[model samples]
Structure formats: C-alpha cells, structure tokens
Target chain A: MTHQQIRGVYSAATTPLNADNTPDLGLFTGHCQRLLKEGCHGVALLGTTGEANSFSSAERRQILEAALKSGLSGDQLMPGTGVAAIPETIELTRHALSVGVSRVVMLPPFYYKGVSDDGLFAAYAQIIETIADDRLRVVLYHIPQVSGVPLTLPLIGRLIKAFPHTVVGIKDSAGDFANMQALVTAFPGFSVLAGADPLLLPLIKAGGAGCITATSNLVADSLRIVYDHANDQARAADVEAAQVRINAYRSLSNSYVQIPTIKAMVGLKTGIASWARPRPPLMALSAAEHADLATKFAQLP
Target chain B: MTHQQIRGVYSAATTPLNADNTPDLGLFTGHCQRLLKEGCHGVALLGTTGEANSFSSAERRQILEAALKSGLSGDQLMPGTGVAAIPETIELTRHALSVGVSRVVMLPPFYYKGVSDDGLFAAYAQIIETIADDRLRVVLYHIPQVSGVPLTLPLIGRLIKAFPHTVVGIKDSAGDFANMQALVTAFPGFSVLAGADPLLLPLIKAGGAGCITATSNLVADSLRIVYDHANDQARAADVEAAQVRINAYRSLSNSYVQIPTIKAMVGLKTGIASWARPRPPLMALSAAEHADLATKFAQLP
Candidate 1:
C-alpha cells in the first residue's frame, strides 16, 4: 500500500454525547467542523479520546452517519471501532469501511495480558478476512499501559506481512519515545503516528508521519503549526518547551485525567464553562481541580 | 444482614466450552458434580478466572441457567456479573438474582482507573435501586492490579453503612495481606473472604470468613480439608505447603497463564485433556510448559 494520505496532525476529537448520554450528533458535527476549521489535517472519531467503546454498536453507527452527513469526509476520518470481541470489532470496522473510512485504528483484544502474539495475529487475520475490504487501512493502536495488551514488533511484522495492504501504520501511545522511534525506524513504508503531542517534533524528525494526540483536543491549531514548521529549529524548540510544561501538568494529575483537563482548558478558552463531564466510572474533576486547571491553563503560553 | 452461609472454600470454576466456543453445558454439569462431591462449599462461575467479561450477557445467562438446571442451588453459586458499563452489569446481575443466585460477586467498573469512590458509590447505588431484589447479597471483588480499579476502605465503609442489608461482604483479592487484614478487622460483621489462596490461613486466623480463590480450581478438596481441619497445625502446614508450590508456579508464569495452567493440571489428573483449551486470546501452553508443570506437580505434597 502506498503511503499517500496518512500524514500531519490528526485530531482524535471527543464525541459530544447528548444529555441522555446518547451521541450528541449536533455537537459532534459542530466539533468536527471546528476541528477542521482550527487546522487539523484530519479527524479520528470515537477513539479513547472520543470514548468510542463507551457507545454501543447502534450509537457508533449513528455517530459515524452523522459525521458523514455533516461534511466530514471519509478521507479525513479515522474512527476507533476496536472491541474485546473480534466479531464486534469486525462488525464496527466493516461499517466504517462501507461508509468510506479507509483508515481505521484498532485496539487489540485487550482483556488478556501476556497473551501470545499468535492469538493477536489470529484476531487480525479473522478481522481482515471477514471484512475483505481492499481499501482497509489498519492502524494498530498501541496503548499497552491502558489496554494491558502490548503490540510488539513481531506481532506488527506478522500482521503487516499477512495483510500488507490492510496494515499500513501504528499509533504508538506507549508514551515511550524509544518505542515510537523504533516503530518509525522498523517499518520503513508504514506510517508510525506518534500518540503524544510532546514527541511530535522528535518523531517527525525520526521519520514519523505525524501525531494523533489527546492534548490536540484543546491545542489542535498550535500542534498543526508545530507540525508544519517542525523543520524550523527555533520554532520546534519553543513548541517542545510548551509541550513540556503541558506534559508536566499531565504527569502530576495522572494522564488518566487528560481528556477532562483538556476539556477544562477548552471550556476556559471558549468561555463555554462546560462541566468536564467524564462518563460515570471516570469521575469528573472536583471544584478545586477545575479552579486549579483554569488558573494553570491561564499561565500557559 | 447476618452473615450465615459464606464461610468455606469457594472455587471460581472455569466454564468448559465446546470446540465451537459455546458453553460445554455437559462438561460444566459434570464439573459441578465433581466439585460438590469433592466437598467444596460453593462455586463461583463467570469470574475473572472464568473469563466472565469475555462471555456475552446471553452466554452468562445461559451458563447460570444451566448451573441451576444441573441442581446447583442459589446458595451454592456466586456469579460474577460486573462490566465497564453500569446498565448492562445491572441487567445481568438482576437476572442472576431472579434466577435464585442471590450471591453475586461484583467487580468495580474497572476499565477506568484513578476514579473517585463517589462514582463507584453511584454505580453500586444504581444497581441496588434497579435490581431492588431483597435477596441480593453483593460481594465486592477487589483485584486492582489487574482491573486497574481499587476499592478503598472509605468507599467500603460508606457502602456498608448506607446499604447494610445489601452489601453483605467483600472478596479482598488485592493479594496484599495488610489490606485484607484491615478489611477483616474493620468490617467485623461483614463477611471478608480471602482472595489469595496463600493468605487463606492468615486471613482465617484474623476473622476472615473464608477464601474465594482462583487456585481453588485445582485444590478445592485440599482447601476444604484444610479449612475443616483448621485446628490441626500439621495438616494446615501441609495444606499451606501445597498452596505455596501452586502459587509459586502461578507467580513464575506471571499469573497471566493461571487459568490455562490450572486447567492443564486438571486435565492431567482427570485424563480429560480437552479441559486444557483456553478461549482465544489465551492460548494453551506448549509441550515444554506441560513437562515443566509435571515436574513441579511431582514435588507437591
């Protein structure tokens, strides 16, 4: 498969669900429009950042349909459809492909750890064979620390070899620069998208395609500018410095609060004052946290 | 609210599925009969050890129904029905209660970690309110290292105080002896079961009711003997030695292969090699591991 359109900063936008906790189609549509307007190269809907697995199959289909209807083209959209079960993941991926999403990021069947690479390969093989979509662009999502399922080089090599056309890239959210660089270097033709915003410049310089980061939720435009001017040394250093401060805060709060903190920043900047309503099971920041975030974000350049 | 029945060895058995991956109802029936014959107090089905989360809701219902049909009474079974989503978990749990399985082990909504106890309370509250089953006896399953979600004492105190009648007990699988002792000491009346097989003696000596252990899959009879013969110092030491051998093997294998490894041991003892087949994403061990286990088993008391 040719590495043609998989480059630059791709924003994994949050799915704005309605008050009923269903996909807020209107808000999602508006968010996509705003993301594109704010200068993201493309958008990845229903990712961890987008909380894709939180929605059921029907809700997922509905969200995708609304995205297409709202002028979000497939060429610019990569939706997360990974599930614990292969059938469900395939069903979701097939739907995405049918709707013209050439690139689909996938999470490994993550419930089990220390799982054999063969099992993961079998899963991918089953999915690829079942879908049989020629335009299928599989980007393996590697967030081991969260999923407890790590996508190693041997597994990646196997998938890419078997479905060379289908498996074109990986999203290294391991948050380890060494792993990110290894991915870029190991898979020459494959697009290795950095999952952290801070590593964007280093990864790009190390032959990475670009980044699909969480903090991109609040800083899409700034990240896009960084991606565009990465070759310019002075500007690149400044971008890294800003990201260092941001990541320092992320480390303090625990990266699990990335979405909420980003949303808090978004509300602060836009004056919308949204409550940073993380779904139940993932608690929303307390009042003190909200106030602290606002004050801290105010100090960011 | 009085703790009556939860004081003995409970084996969280694996559901032996057929080649088609459907529940092997016949195998399970036989398995249950054997466990009862061997003198286990009760059996916990669809637990993390049983890959409960991997099975669909329909599968869980079917398995529970089969167990009921096979003469396992409500008092003799504890089904694990917790998932990431509250509504689905509630639905499945309510079904278990209705079908006469009053004792249900509930895992915390574990996918999202670093969540506040308030969120956990809301989740449990929703389940209790929706089910409204007077017979409901909830045993909170605490295995934070795997689930990425921890159940702190404050949350436990709040739940027990608020729903004294419903929140009957907890299975402290944190594997930390101090934490388990704290739970046993703090909730004097509440049934605190040891989650670790190795800690069974210590926990029992410290006011714990019994153990809900994964290793009970292979050594239920021995565990039962030890529990019944707790006063015999030499016998308890023998049982502890056997448990250490099993647990050491478990730790050496990283605990990821605990289910399959135990099943392999069962297969070796019963001459039912089909029992070794673990579900996809969890492959069966190779010949080398089988040989190693055989050598280790010979050294066991």
Candidate 2:
C-alpha cells in the first residue's frame, strides 16, 4: 500500500441535469455529498457517466468549480480533464489545480487512431511539461471502448518514469482484470483503480488500489463496505453481500444505455426525476424502459 | 451536378508549424494561396489532413482567421469546426459565420463509440439549432477510421431533411466508394465529396460533387483538372492522366504515416523543411524516412 497514492471507492458520479438540459449544479453537488456520506472516498466528477465530453469547456470548468464551491475539499474530488486536443487538456488540468484540486484523470489525445507510442508519449510529455506543477497528480484514463485511445503498459511506464511523483495512478475502465493485474505487477506503488464496480473487491485483494466506477454512483455504501473489509475473515459474509448488491445495481444500470440508465437509477434512488435527464448523444430512458427498470430495481439486494 | 451545393477540388491543406510548434500563420496562409493559384477551388484548412483536431479551439480559430486575413475569401476557406465537444463546435462554427465564412467541415461528437443514430442526430440537430445562422452550411465529415463516430446514411438523411439549407454536404473519407455511391444514390442534391484522392474521377463520373482530400495539398492541379473535365469526352485522356498523377502523390504519402508524410512531402514540394513539423500526437518523419520520401517525391508527376 506504499504506492497507494489514491485508494478508495470513488464514485464516477453521474451529473444531474435541469429540464433545459444544463447541469443542475445544486443537485449534482448534493449527489456528491450523498456519495461521500454513503462511504465514497472521493467524487470523480466529469467522467464518462457524467457526460463530460458532451459539455463545453466552460461548462466543465463550471461543474468542477460548482463541486468545489459546494464545500467538497480539493482532495475529495478527481475530475477527468483529458480531451481530444492537448492544449485544452492542459488548460482543464491547470484549471483543476488552480482551484486546489491536484489529482486529475486524463485521457490521451484521442482524435487520431493507431498513433505511434512516440506520438502519444510526446503528447503527454508536452502537456505535463507545459503544465509544470509539483503538486499535480495525474491518473491516466484507459477506456478504449469509449475514447478509442488505449493507454498501453509501455506508455504508462514511460509516464511513471518521466514524472514519478506527478503520474500516480490509472483508471482502468477497459473492464479487463488481466490488464489491471498486469499494471499492478509492472508498476509497484502506482495506483491501479478499477473502472468497473464488480472488480473493485478482486482488484483491492490483488494489490490494486481501489475503484473510480459508475455503479458506485448508486451503491457507494455497498462498495465502501466491500472495500473496508474485503480482507477481514470475520466480515467475509458482509463483503460478499455488499458485492452482490453492487453487482445488482451494476447489472440494472448496464441493462440500458449505461449512462442514461445510471442517471435514471439515480433518480429512482433519490426520488428526483430531474436526475434522469442526460444531455444529448445520451437520451433519457423511455417510459416503458423506466417501468421495467423500476420493477427490476426494486428487487435488487 | 445540378444538385451540387459545394462543388470543387478543395485541398484539405496541410498546416505547417514553426520550430516552437505554433501554427506558422504566414506559411499556412501562403500554402492556402498556393493551393488556390494551383487550381484548387478552395483551401479546406484545419481538416484531418491539416491536423485540426490536434490544435486547441483558439488555435483552430487563429488558423482559419489567418487564411481569411491572407486575402482568401470566406467562400474559399472551409475550416473544420466540429470537435468532440458540441459547444466548442458551435462556438467555432459561429466564429466562422461572424467572419463571413459560411461553410465548415463538421465531424460528429467523437468521444463515445457505438452511439445510436438517434443520439447522434440529437447532437447535430441541437448544435445546428443553437447556431441558427442562415449563412451556415455544414459539410458533415465521415472519416470513420480517424473519427470513430460514423455519420451513417440514415443520420445524414435526417440532417439534410431537418435543415435542408444548412446541412449541405458530406466529406466521405471512409475510403469506401460503395458508401459514397449509396450516398449519391440516396441523397441526390446533397454534396458527396470524395475524401480519398483516386476516387475523385470515378466519384465525379458517378454524380458526386467533387472532393475535399489530402492529396489535393500536393497535386491540386491534377485534381482540379480531373474535376473540371470528368464529363468532357474530348478531355477523357486528360482526366485519366491527371488521376494517375494524383494517385502517384497519394501512394507516396500513404507509404508512411499519411498526415506527417504529406506534411513532409509538402516540405519537399515547397523546399521549406519547416513544413515537415507536425503537432504532437502526430510526429514528423525521421531524417531517413524524409530522405527516402524526398527521393521518391522528386520522381512524382
């Protein structure tokens, strides 16, 4: 755990939007607080589930600012600052630091596919160097399914070697445990956070750090229970039960288009209908789907 | 031809960078002027070939503004305004409109993959409605290889039908002639511009509206000749010869990583080595690759 710079069940919090589709800042910050109250270590705001890419840079800055202004300490937040372009990624990361948030989850410059490792390394190096700050802690984001950019082992190693203190962790959302295991094996002390909910227990047991996941948006308490006592022999039954609950929430969330469904589930969890509204390119679930989900959601552990 | 809204051999011009990697505004503008003088209908600056996605929004605006300031008319500069973020795309497009430029090659919001046609439709529809500029003409960019988001035919049809005047054309860079043919067959009046160089002749003959291609950066005259005389029975040999010349340049460029090699070849063509510098996430050719390419480039038509 010496290299466990970021260790906990951090919620990849889904953003709550108003009827006009703008981010409902008040609702979003309240949800962040609830995740914390329920045992989330930190709030990974502005992630895939949060629909960060759909919003403008100004909105992204405002969302992070709003979360901070809501009284969440900087260390309790890890915002995704990576984007298709390098300058904006740098700007977003700097913006996070300017507001006292030091840790950031960054995706690679994802516009070009099949880019050489040299090219990717150069992009990251240039960005990190340009935003030269000793306090910066970057958790590389590897979600090839969504971003079309996979942060490879060699690239991660290069980043770690170049900026050992700055580049601390990774959010392995590729949903591959083998990859996470390999990352743990390769880089000791470098945090390996699970991007999926179900893997958090196994990953933590396997010398991995923790998780920054979507299901945590709904079942943070269960995840926190699992994380707190996964290794406790006397609490083995509790761990198993919490895991089942987390899986139930994850399964229901994945039953529809994942992000929108998670937002809807959040609405059902909090009894707030506006929580169901996702921005464009991610539609709100239809009435029939919502009813079906509500039935299944009620039956969860 | 009758339904052609955007018809011409528009060079997807390669942007040259200075030593510090800033857009060499002077060289870029000169390249645009040269592209026009060499028979290109317009300079499609800040495109895939131009490495538009690599630059920040501010940089993209500056490059486009530099072209317009260098005496290129608004009609002769089709900058790529679309990005993964819709608001920035809207802002960039609006900026273009404000400067008297109407047409922009817009890529779909590309961060999320396997998104539904409905979601994508909503994204573009919302952006267009938000812009709400009558002078705005968007040429939908469809390069699935580079931009993971594909502008499917159904989606394109919906866009054209929804905003008949604003949604004017498509840059079909999937390198699939069959898809281009289907688009031409399905949407008669919508501009179906070839993304590849060799397809220009066949696409034009098959009733497509010219091209917006990378090779046009190197061999604009040949592409211009092919477009101007594809239907002229007397100029059949000229078109064939021009197409052959165009293919030669394309093949050499493709021999290496396409964009950087094209930038390097542009350096060779203009005898300014500075043209070889590409922004990060896109590397310059090694000295050896450049030397080999230079030798072969000298032998090209």
Candidate 3:
C-alpha cells in the first residue's frame, strides 16, 4: 500500500500486566475490542508502552494469541517482537508471521552503541533472508532516543530499495518531525508512521501515514477523527488544540508513565478495570500525579 | 562473600557464530576451557562480547550446556541473561539458577529512556520476588551508555537494602572511577566490579571487586596477574604497563568495534577460530581498522 493509502490512526495499546505480574490476557482482549470499536484502524501491541522488551517469547506468543481470540486478525494487529538478539527476533517474527501477523514492527538491536548503518542493514538483511516467508511484512521501528539504535534516512531508503515488498513501512517514534519529513520525502509509497500522537496531522499532511501513538491508548477516538480529517482546514484548529493539550500533559508527569496513566484514564471512563498498576521499577502513579493527570485529561475536548 | 573478596579477572567470552551463523558450540567450549586454564577466575559466556543479546533462550541454554560439558561449573560461569523484558529476564535467570549458574548479570529493561529508577526497581524487584529461589544471585549490569537505562545510586541502594542477599554485585561499565567508588563506598559488602580494564587498580585500592572485562577475552592471564598483584607496588607497575598496552591497541581502531576486534585478536592468538563474527548490526572490522589494531597490539608489552 502507498503512504497516503495507509493513513489511519493506530492505537499502540498498553499490555495489561496482572496483579501477579503475568500478562493479563483477559484485560488485553477487552482493551483491543474497545480500541477497534472506537474506530482505530489497527492496534500496535507490544510497543514501548506495551513493554514488549519485558515479555518472554512465550509470553509474547500468548498475548498475540489472546488478541487473536478477541477476533483481532493480522490486519487489526502489528505486534512488537524485535529483540537485541537475531535468533530471538527471528523466532518471534517468524511465529508472528505464522499466526497471520504479517505486519511486524521491529526495533533494531539497540544494546551496542556507535553501530554503523552498514551494521543496521546487516541485521535487517539477515531477518528478511531467514524468514524467507513472503507473508511477512516488516515495519522498521525508529525510536532512536530510547533504542539508541537509529534507523537513519539512508538505512531506511536502502532497506526499502533492497526489499521493497518486505520492508513496506516505518514507525518514526524519534519524535523528530524533520526526520519524519525526510522519510516522507524520500520514500513515496512506503508507509512512514508518526509515532507521536501530537504529530498526526502534520505528518499526514507531509504525505505520511497515521500515528501509532502512546497517548492514543487514552484518546483514540479523538485521534481517529484527527487522522480522518487531517487535511480539513476547518478542523485544523481543533486538531492543533488537542495536540497542545496532550503535549502539555506529557510535559509534567513522566511520559514513560503514559502507559499506566492511559490505562488509569481508560478505567475511569469505561470500567474494564480499576487501579492501573504498572509493573515495578515502573511504579503505579502517585495520588498527586494521577490527580494531576486526571484533571488535565478532564480538560481534553 | 565479603567486600574484600571476589577479586580476579573475568573474561566475557565471545560465542563463535559458525559460517552459517549458527552458534558454534564446540568453539564456545574450547574458548571456555582455554580461559579457565589461563588462570581466569571464571568465564562469562554470552555477555555483550559473547553477543548475549543475539542468542535465543535455547541457544543460550546450549552454550551453557556446552560449558558444563567442557568442565565449567555453574559457580565458575557468570552468564548475561538480561533481556529488554522482565519475563525473559526471569526465564533466563531462573534457567541459569536451575543449572547451578548462580551469578547472572542482568541489563535493565532499556527500550524506554528517562525511565524512573522506580520503574527499574519494579523490574528487578519483580524478578527477585517471583523467582522466589534462594539459589539466585543477581548482579546488576549497569551500562547506561548502551542500555539507555541507568541504574542510579539511589536505585542500587534501594535494591541492595530491599533484597540484600539476591542483589550480590554490580558491573559498572560506565568506565567512571568516581561512580565505581560511590558504589563501592555505599554498599559495604557489595561486589563492585569495574567494567573498564584500566580502572582495576584504582577500583581494587578503593575496596572494589574484580573486573568483568571484555579485553580479558584476549589477555585473561595478564589481567589476572595484574588484578592479583594490585597491592604490590612493583607488580602494580607491570599491570599498569599492560593496561596501557591494551588501551593503546583499543584506542587506535574505531572504539565502536572494540568487542569484535578483541574477539578477533583472541581468535588469532588461540587459533581455535579463524574469525570473530559479532552478530548482525555489528559487522567485522574493516581491513584497515584490523591492521591498525594489529600494529598497536604488536607494540603492547
């Protein structure tokens, strides 16, 4: 599909870790259904917010299975399965492809720093060669700030040129619009996704695909409207206003806490569950932080 | 056991990837045996140099099995089992513990940046509590520059105090002597190993433990001698000379290629393998870089 043709808001759903800290399969399915019903084009589970890195391969498979059980097919899901290791990444990606999850968003191996573009190319090359499955559609995940492993413009362009069909798109979560524009300008039809919710309209206007945003976990429907009417001059004010509101909220509390905070807002609004508990090392939001987040979110249009 | 204890040079061996790129188990065992004979304290298999992040759980198990088959016990080996996810970290840590591999170094869940120490504490706390196994001895792998997840002083203090027994030590690859000193001073009995080879004397004089170093992969015997004789002025000078020699060699080439370059040099010296193939996204050293590295090594004492 072309870049413009691939436009639609994608909710990067939060993977609910249970009280005992296992993958809460039941809650995950409910969340997926809610997102789909709210009109999100698809759900990208296991992104940074989904805590994909914190899950085991078996656990990853189980979550993917649970999402499937909820009737979210390959088209409705793009699972995060990339790892620092090649074998594990290939194993997860292959399994994802087998379960009809053709579209996989992969983070580059980010453990080692100062790696060259040549090295990045080698990693992607090895995966495409090993999978050898025509059904697999890889979306290069570019979240350089966190991954420390960047998907540069040249590297993205090279991958697209080498394996046009396999590497169909990219999710630019670098939060840098200049880089996003370069991708949009460089690869005409390649789906260049805006990973930041705030950049949805500008990115779409720059000939890019929709966003797979973290905040969309809370405000997905509004994000969907923003994506659907991205080019509408009449709605530009509303879109810019909403983006500003979300950005303001993110600036206060740790944006890394956005996952649990989004889930907290979801619980407040829809009643799937109460007490949004993020797994430790990442604590549940404090009363003050939550109260603050809720007050600001209450201000959302 | 004590703060004054746990001193020696530990080699983080490289897992030799075969021509087909499958982990060469035989070469792995051969390297381990050679390291043990070289008078090294233990063999740290599947570390960054070993490309721990590049292997599957099954592959990691196989390498561990081969090390055992070649006569290394669990206590004699420290495996790098940290994943970007908690469950995988638990699985690998549990497996290592089950196999009697007690000393498992863990990297923080690194896909997200600016992660609150509370989030990191949550990750480590969950692993320790859930495992509920007494045999587990945790070593925090602090390589912030690589993982983008820094294990801050306060976080370390919290983890040590909370799970005193389970949180055994830390390998500070930050390469900052002051940070290493703070860790040494704070946790009285904690094993604070320096990640940088050159910091051994300063660390040891400061009541630090042994080094979990990459360069030891090439020169374990010399590093061991230096580490053992750190107290003696004459022997310390010899050690300092060797450190200078090794550091000169490392500095000549692109420091980015340190892991593969060191592995290649080891392979060259031992003749057990022809090439040091780091996993994808990390290519082999270029011919010019390789020659420069070789020239610098020849000049080492």
Candidate 4:
C-alpha cells in the first residue's frame, strides 16, 4: 500500500497480560481483531500503550505471530519496533518486514537526553543501513514528552531526503497541534498520524493523514466518524460536535494514569478483570477509581 | 559482601566500544582492571557513563563475563543490570548473582513516566521474587534528570522495609546535595553513594558512602584522595581545595555531552583515538572541543 492508504483510525492497542504477567496471546489477538472490526482502519500494536518497552524481544515476536495467525491482515497492522538498543530495534523491525509487515513506528535511542541532530540522524541511518531491507517502511515515533527525545524537523527532513521510501510517515504524539501542523505543512504528501484523539479532526482537516491514538481502542468507531466527515462542508458541525464529546471523555480520564485508565475502561466493557492489570511501573486503577470511571463512562453519550 | 564494605571511590566506568560500535570486551575489561588498580575502591560497570542501555543484553553479559574471566573479582565489580523489561532485568541480575557478583545498581523501569510508588514497588518486587536469590543485593539508581523517573524517599523507605536485606543502598545522582542529605539522614547506615564528583567530599562528610562518579574514569586517583581525607580535620581544608579543582574541570567540560566528553578524555589519556567513538545516540566531541578539553585537563594540578 502507498503512504496515502496508511490513513484513518488506528488503535494503539494495549497488550493484555495474564495474571502471571505473560502476554495473553489469545486475549491480545482477540482485542486486535475486535478493534479492526470496530471501524479502526488498523491496529498499532506494541506502541507505548501496548507496553512495548516492558516486554522482551522474544515475547514481542510471539505476539506478532499470534496476531497474524489469528487472521489479522498484515496490511491492517503496524507494530512499534523501537527499543533503546539498535540491534534489538533492527531485529524487531527486520522480523516485522520479513513477515510482510511493511510499516513500523520507531522511537529514537531515548536513553541519552539532549542528543545532537547529527547523532539522531546517525541512529536512523545506521538502522536503515543495518537492516538493509528496501521493503522496510518507518513511521518515526515522535513523543518527546515520554521518550525525552524529539525528532526535530531538520532530522526528519534529512531522513526523508536520504530514504524517501523507507521513512514515509510519522506519529506525532507531542500533543501540540502547532508541531503537527508544522509537520503536516512541511511534508505535504507524508503520512502524518495524530497520536491524540482530540487532534484527529483538525489534523485530518489540515491536509494530513488520520490518527493512531490510544483511545482508538475504545472509541475508534466514534473517531472514524470524525475522520470520515472532517472534509464534508455540511457535516462540519457534526464532526465538531463528535470531537467535543471525544475530548470530554479524554478530559474525564485525564486525572487518571492514561494507559491503566484505558485498560480499566476496556475491562469494564468486556467484563474481564485481567485486562485491567497493567504491567509494573503502570499501576492498575484502584477499585474506587474504576467504579467512578464506570459511572462516568456510562454518563457519556 | 556486607553493605558497609560497598564503599569508597567507584568509577562509573565508560564502556569502550570498538570501531564497529560493538562493545570492545578486551578494552572494557582492561579499563575496569585499570580503574580498580588506580585507587578506585571498586568498578561500577554498565552505568550511564558505560552506555549500558545502548547495548543489548547479550553484549552486556559478554562484558561481565570478560571482566570476570580477566581476573577481576566479583566483589570489586557492581554492574548496572536494570532494563526497561522486568524479565530482562531478572535475567541479567540472576546471571550476575550466579557468577558470584552480588551487589547491583538498578534503575527503575524508566520508559514509563510518572509511575506511582506502588507500581515502582511492584516492578522491583516482581524482579526480586522471580530471581528468588537470597544473596541478591540492590543499590537503587536515582538519576531523575536522566531516567525521568525519580525514586522518592517514601518509595525507598517502603522497599527497604519490605526487603531489608535485598535493597541495601542507593546512588543518588539527582545532583542535589539536600536530596542526598535527606537520603543519608533518613536512612542511617544505608549505603548512599553520590553520583557527581563535586559531592564526594560533602557526601562522605555526611556519613554517606563515597561516590560512583563518571569523572572517576579519568580522575579516580584524585577522587580517592578526597574520599580518604574526608574525615581528617587537619586535611579538611586541603581536601576542599582539591575538590574545587576537580569541580572546575567538571565545569569546563559541562558544555559538551557527558559520555562522549569522558570518552574523549580517556582517549587523550590512553592515546587511543578509537576510544573516542561513542555509540550512535551519543556524538563524539568535536575536534575543537577535544582540543580545548586537552588544554584544560593539562592545567589541572
């Protein structure tokens, strides 16, 4: 598929771990399949919401295999293949490509803070060179808030110039529309996916691609409505109305830790308690918080 | 070894990478050996200065094994075994223990930001419980500036209370002496190693353990003098004078990226240009910067 085809609502799907903390492959694949069926254009597995950094390389491969075997099409999946180590990133990215998965979102080596643009360029160049896979397509994951490493426009421009086909897209999770607008305006034809749900309508309206957001796991059908109606002059008000409600839902849970709150919402919807348990360093929502969330979610239109 | 013995000047040694960016095990082992022989009480391998996060698990294991095989005692070595993944952390920690290396400095699962103390506790508990080694000892690594995850005093208190024998010490790299003082005063008898060279005298004077500083790679012998004379009333003024000079050197190179600056300094000392090549995320010092550093280093008494 071309870069333009890689658009629309993509769920930053969370990985469901068993009580013992191993990836519940059955649950994970089932969730991805459900997200696809629920109007999500695709499922972005193993992104931050998926706890990608918290799982071993071997475990991540197993997850990909399980999702593929469960009938999820490679065309509808984008796995995060980034890690602090370059070799591991290459291993994950190469494996994804070898299995016919073309598009992968990668974070820069984030351990070092305040790295030079030259260093960041060298990192991407090294990965592209080392992988040596012409078929490999990279969506630069730019979430400086969490990663503490920003992929500045100059670095992105250089990478695109050097490897136009390989570096085709980016997921701008910086939560700043100006940055997203700058990116979308600067690279007209590039696939610029908003990482936040609230930016979906504005970003889509700004000659950009759709979103790959965490809330897509729960609200993909609603987000898809905004994406589908973003450009329709008659439906402009309807799109704005829908986006406001989505933003309200996002704001309601803004007080809680994002990943676990989303997981708890999923658990409430599915009646599966195990879905609520985020791996360590991401605490599960407290009993009181979960009950309150259920009440608030019920109140949402 | 008891927590008390885990003291004095420990170099947060830099990992020497070869021309191809792979860990130079020969050079790495040689560097560790040299640090121990040059007035360092012990060698702290795989800390930030060592670029531990940038190397793969297999590579780190190789480095540890090489150091041990090259006649370095486990008692004189403290490896940074923390990784974003809990299983990977356990594997590395268990490997260190099985090889008779007991004391380890571990960073929290740092990829996730704003994690709760409970969640942080859960992460550590899972690792300690999974490893299930009675001989396991941990020195919590708190460099919130770099890790973006702070190990608050409350969290430390809970961990120590829960795992008194297992959580033995901490290397507070917050760069705030007040925080270090709180840690030292709050937990009397706990090993609190300062992470900066300038804090070595004050930290040691405050009943804290000596430092595990990055600059020790180049100035271990001088740091040893401060550690040795911290309690000497007559030499207290003399120690302060020496510390001012060391602090000045640190300040001169503060404008450059830290890991590469130290790598460049080591290269200048050893006359090996290859030692100056940092991994991808860390750029090497510019020629002008290196020349300036050489001149400043020469001015040191």
Interface RMSD of each: 2.2, 0.9, 1.4, 0.7
**lDDT, candidate 3, A49-83, per-residue tens:** 78777677888899998899889888889998788
lDDT of each residue in B170-229, candidate 4, tens digit only: 999989999999988888778999999999988888888888998888877778889999
Supply DockQ values for each candidate.
0.36, 0.87, 0.77, 0.84
lDDT of 2 by residue, A1-301 (tens): 4647899989999988888778899999999999999999999999998899988889999999999999999999999999888889999999999999999999898889989889989998999999999999999999999888888999999999999989999999999999999999999999999999999999989999899999998899999998999899999999999999988899889898999999999999899988888887778899999999999998988
- Between which residue pairs do clashes occur in model 1? none
**Clash counts for all predictions:** 0, 1, 15, 0
Error of 1 at A120 (Å): 3.7
lDDT of 2 by residue, B1-301 (tens): 4567899999999989889888999998999999999999998888899989988899998998888888999999899999988888999999999998999999988888888899999989989999988889999999999888888889999999999999999999999999999999999888999999999999989999999999998899999999999999999899889988999999999999999999999889889999999998999999899989989998987
Regions more than 4 Å wrong, model 1:
A1-5, A17-23, A53-62, A98-102, A129-132, A232-256, A298-300, B1-5, B130-132, B232-256, B294-301
Q: What ordering of candidates by DockQ runs from best to worst?
A: 2, 4, 3, 1
lDDT for position B266 in model 2: 87
Q: In model 2, which regions exceed 4 Å deviation?
A: none
Return the TM-score for candidate 4, rounded to 2 decimals. Answer: 0.97
Q: Model 3 chain B — which ten-residue stretch has the worst lDDT?
A: B247-256
**lDDT by residue (tens digit), candidate 1, B139-241:** 9988886777789999999999988888978888878999988887788678888877777777777777888877776777767765666667768677666
Instruction: Quote the lDDT for B137 in model 1.
Output: 85
Isolated chain A TM-score, each model: 0.92, 0.99, 0.91, 0.96
For this target, which candidate reaches the highest lDDT against the unseen true structure? 2
lDDT per residue for candidate 3 within B143-205, as digits (tens), equals: 887777789999999998999878888989888899999988888989998887778768887
TM-score of predicted chain B versus true chain B for each candidate: 0.92, 0.98, 0.93, 0.96
Candidate 3 is scored at a TM of 0.94
